[model samples]
Target: MSSISIRKAVLSDLETLLELEQGVIKAERPLDPFLGKGELNYYNIPEMISNKNTHLLVAIVNNEVVASGYVRVENSKIYHKNVKHGYIGFMFVKENFRGQRISNLILDSLKNWAKENSLKELRLDVYSNNTGAIKAYERFGFTKSLVNMRTEI
Candidate 1:
């Protein structure tokens, strides 16, 4: 098997990253009912790449971008002890690349970046029914801390 390497995403990586973002939305639409039907965007790639508070990363294999994710620095809630934390999102690994622990590598790098920035906590939101993703994050040492509830008004 070819080795996987993780690197910071650049503006040139935008095309592949956009497709990967669609992949994520496609996989998640069934798990979420509130998503819009056409051309939905969950992130701003160029701004993210240029933002000092965000770290966008892509996973490369055999000179191709196959997976992508990002972590952004966010202010903690006023009640929280820490002033800031890393908010992880857009974690999508291509279908062909699943089960290879590439996500773990991405998480490790993001965690390191957060620590280097003196952020004491890392947090992310996962679909409540996405058991596979939940298990993966659990295996990576993340504990369940919140469950956002919603209903039709």
Candidate 2:
């Protein structure tokens, strides 16, 4: 494993981020009912990286983004206790980059950012079927605090 540098994403990294997002969507298609057939909007990359309340982190290998994750501050009535909390989302590590501890580094970067922003808690929602991701979060000290159900209309 080469040295993987994790950094905050900028507008210049949009294209690479979009590619990463698409890769994750494709990988999850078999297990995720919400992921349908379509390409992700590459134009939204700028917004995703620059959103004032969001933190986008990327792991770069040889100047290319191979892994990415995001943290957003949202006000929630229940899980957040009506206060601002950090929510992790859009986490992805390129297939070839797995087992290198890159995801853990990205997560640590996000957690550091959350702490710097004075967030009291961090939360995330993983698909019930994504046991791998659930286990990863569990290893990071995340507990099952809530159960969510969905109804397809």
Candidate 3:
């Protein structure tokens, strides 16, 4: 841990973010093996970078990116009580950088971003089998909010 810093992600960081995303997808695929391998750019980075309602953050050590995450303001369906919420996603930290509080920095950054956007609640979807991530999220004060179940027909 040599002076880790969390900063807003910029368009110039596109390549680095994509590289980290590759590692994240590979690491998480086992949790959702049914999905197999596929591209996962559900939220466009460039668009998010330019969107005022989204905050993309990166953790860096000595100016080199070691981890990243983002929180975006989302609108719920008309039927939901919570109309607006912060959706955290695309979190990743390099293997060598684990246990260094990098995720905390990312989460703190997102918390501030969410508050600034006047969001009262935050939500994220995780693969049920990703116990490590579940524990990590729990350490950050997040608890199980919902569950989705399915089976092959």
| Residue pairs that clash (backbone atoms under 3 angstroms), model 2 | none
Ranking by lDDT: 1, 3, 2
True-vs-predicted CA distance for residue 119, candidate 2, Å: 0.4
| Candidate 2 C-alpha lDDT tens digits along 26-87 | 76678767655676542366887778888999999988789998889988686536478899
Q: Write down the TM-score of every candidate.
A: 0.98, 0.89, 0.91
Cα displacement (angstroms), candidate 2, residue 146, comes to 1.7
TM-score: model 1 vs. ground truth: 0.98
Query: Which prediction has the highest TM-score against the true structure?
Result: 1
- lDDT winner, 1 or 3: 1
**Candidate 1 per-residue lDDT over residues 18-94, each given as its tens digit:** 99989999999999999989989899899999999999999999999988888999999899999899999999999
Cα RMSD of all models vs. native, in order, equals: 0.7, 2.1, 1.7
Q: Of models 1 and 2, which has the larger lDDT?
A: 1
Instruction: Kindly indicate the candidate among 2 and 3 with the higher TM-score.
Output: 3
Model 2 RMSD in Å is: 2.1
